[model samples]
Target chain A: MNRTTELHPFSVPRYPSGNPAQRVIVQVLVTQDAGQQRHAQLLARADTELRHLALPQYADEAALGEALATLLSEARVGVHLELHGDEAFIWSLCGVARAAGLLGDEITLQCNESGRRMLFCVHCASLQAGTCADLQPCRQCGVMLEVRRHFSERLGAYLGVCADADQPYAQARP
Target chain B: MSALDARVGETRLITPVIREVSLMPVNGTLPAFSAGSHVQLHLPNGKRNAYSLLSDPGDTSHYRIAVRQQAQSRGGSRYVHEQLQTGDQLKISSPANLFPLHSTARLHVLIAAGIGITPFLAYCTELLRRGAAFELHYAYRAGLSDAYVEVLREQLGEHLHLYESSARRLDLGQLLGHRPLGTHVYACGPQSLLDALREQSLALGWPAARVHWEAFAAPEPGVPFVVELARSGRQVAVGAEQSLLEALESAGVELPNLCRGGVCGQCRTPYLKGDVEHRDLFLAHEERASSLMPCVSRGCGSPILLDI
Candidate 1:
């Protein structure tokens, strides 16, 4: 339906607009209470052919991982993905999408939580999730981490290393 | 870093279509670089092209690159193949790496198609020196193309596998199956190859962190659009093959630019109007609300109004 012309998959102004695919497969991932209403709304927007996969409201980081794996394996390539949830949940979805090799241009990441986000580590790089306050906790072999920036494109998690070693605590500060 | 003078040391025909061009800096030694580093050469036609360094990054004696002559000679490759000679002095940008190897991957899986094997040449060197666990799987048309097969086989030995013609179809499911927890895959080849690898890696549940790729060619040249300069009120037509940055330059308008490929953020310009198709990775998502990287980004509906 010439959908590509109106909204470039990964481009900004993502929707100047286009027609929804007939029998289009839309995946709606719901994670938090605040995102439930939007999740329902997104479901209404999709056609009956839309494939649905839902994570429990209290789904933790691991559940998000499993959900993403299902999405990558089950979601038809070139189909649209609608992520309805909090920043952490959204990041989790993004991390999974990335691991499954979905490019930012390939899917739509709709974050329900607009507030500043704090990412949960999968503990893949280091099994340490988000318990520490500083970017660097003398815990990981003298390595300092910058909590907010340097997101891993593939993992969808923010890379927690101090981007600049000289200024180790930049993320901790305002 | 600014460009320095280099002479074409030696050039050889690596394959039916690929030419190996060796470059040596006129002054002292060239700067040391990492495995996936590439250097840009300024051609006499005023066009610049970046090529991955195929020589050992440790020995800066001279840098080597494999250039494949495309159906469309953008003048850059043609200049190197046709006019450039052993004694010809050329200006080359310092080596820069947008595709650096990950320092933490436990097991590395390298995949390539045709000339996509260029960057991995240097990577094999460093990986071997560090005694890293790695394997390279290559695919090519049976008799059509295979750039550095001999060299890779000799160095990689049993570690390298080549799939010719009908078997060239990569079974990514099997390749990415049961990957160790920290295994990482790097693919540089045709967009189709990268897409397949990425899809299978993701489907098999590989962490996005470990699926690395570098495009064999530049980003797709987008649809034709227009740019209206606010200062002079001049209109410039940007062709599909041309970027906003090039169109403005052709119109005698100049903006700061470094790696014309959009790695360097120097060409960003404030925009006053029109929907921008931001194609670059340089600017943050929010930054695009007010500005754009002219080198890669373009206008969608109407002519983009630039503050320039």
Candidate 2:
């Protein structure tokens, strides 16, 4: 099926700039490359001072997770969270915020418009990132897969199932 | 609601005006309750009063409640303080929770004034058991109304913050301001204190869902009026000193109710016609057009036609 709004359940979301009801605005970016422009847009619309936290692309992810957890645990009642990054990166941080007790209304996710997306291979239970395609081979099990509209925020990936079960494996994608 | 037969197991003076009463079920084990749950006590003077259960929720053998003798006693408080004794048989309604803890709160901030500390007694115990982070802010007079200060301080250590109102007033604005994210604040106190907390929290842009409160005072007396039940076609005259719910009960018409203070939206009755004076903390503006809380609301001049 085509990537029409009605066909794709995992359509890109429209993020509001800022909420006036929030007393504090926190912008967390996984990478400063494409996220800087979105961060600037959020800052322009925010009435309150925006606290910016940038996670270096090559830094120790575990250490960054610990720091983000600490920061979220100390956040106050009227704080709003803005996340900017690719689906995998942003959803990972979103999970951390959720674990720290931030409700859905308090958080906004802005996924980068780049063609790269995370795809979860259902057959092999493997995760592959980079390039959105209708049909691709699972990196680990080499199964020809069809990208489905179903997306799991917890897994931070679109689901990929074996395409044309009659002909499985990489050979199926003649 | 089924009534539980209980007897006063113990009674002691918590303070000069406050009495801590323990009740044990006359029959089998009592039903378990959570923090912020309260039971309606059928008083000796034929008056029913709701009191917060202050004991640990895990304890099913007995329930504890503290009663502060109101100077303007409408008989319930006076009867409990003056005549109620140990071993006295009593009837209490099953526990109902009106001010439950916010389900996803990362940090719980509890604020209490005077006898309002009762519900938080159980909250603190439950929170501690869960190993959750919390702080209790209590404002009370040192001698007159500080019922649980010593025990709370000993149990909570630095987590308990006390403000003796007689010595200095509690700064509500500062207390509500600068709270960390995921913080849910619960307040139980007199109407004035509850009002101040609501105002301060709103000014700080705190979400209404994050701030919770339970007022301790019963419904204030309103102008006398008459109510006509639509279903039974019976008319009951409500006195100036009696609530509409009390009047209905007196006339043998019982409505399912909890927290007759009007915060719990249990007794929301549809009104066909009347000049309704809505005093409840629950209903929205649009809801007031179609329904009214008979527990605290009243009719002005005209007789109310209730769906009942």
Q: What TM-scores do the predictions have?
A: 0.60, 0.82
Look at candidate 2 and give me any clashing residue pairs: A75-B180, A75-B181, A76-B180, A76-B181, A77-B180
lDDT of 1 at A120: 33
- Poorest lDDT segment (10 consecutive residues) of candidate 1 chain B: B201-210
List candidate 1 stretches off by more than 4 Å: A1-174, B219-228, B231-242, B247-259, B262-266, B274-291, B297-302
Q: For residue B278, what is the lDDT in candidate 2? A: 92
* Model 2 Cα shift for residue A106 (angstroms): 2.4
lDDT by residue (tens digit), candidate 2, B182-286:
788999998898888877876676767778888984777767899899988989999887789888888887788888878888889998887899999889999
TM-score of 1: 0.60
Per-residue alpha-carbon lDDT of candidate 1 for residues B1-308, written as tens digits (9 for 90 to 100): 47879999889886777889999989998988889888878776656677899899889889999898776664667777788888888899888887788876667889888888888999999999999999998887754577777777888998898887686666888887755434678988877887788677655545465678877544346789888889889899988766777777677777766567665677789989899988876799888888998877888996788887
> Residue by residue across A77-162, what tens digits does model 1's lDDT show?
33445555544555566667656644454445555334334433322255333432434442444345555433443444444554
* Leading candidate by DockQ: 2
Question: What does the lDDT read for residue A72 in candidate 2?
Answer: 75
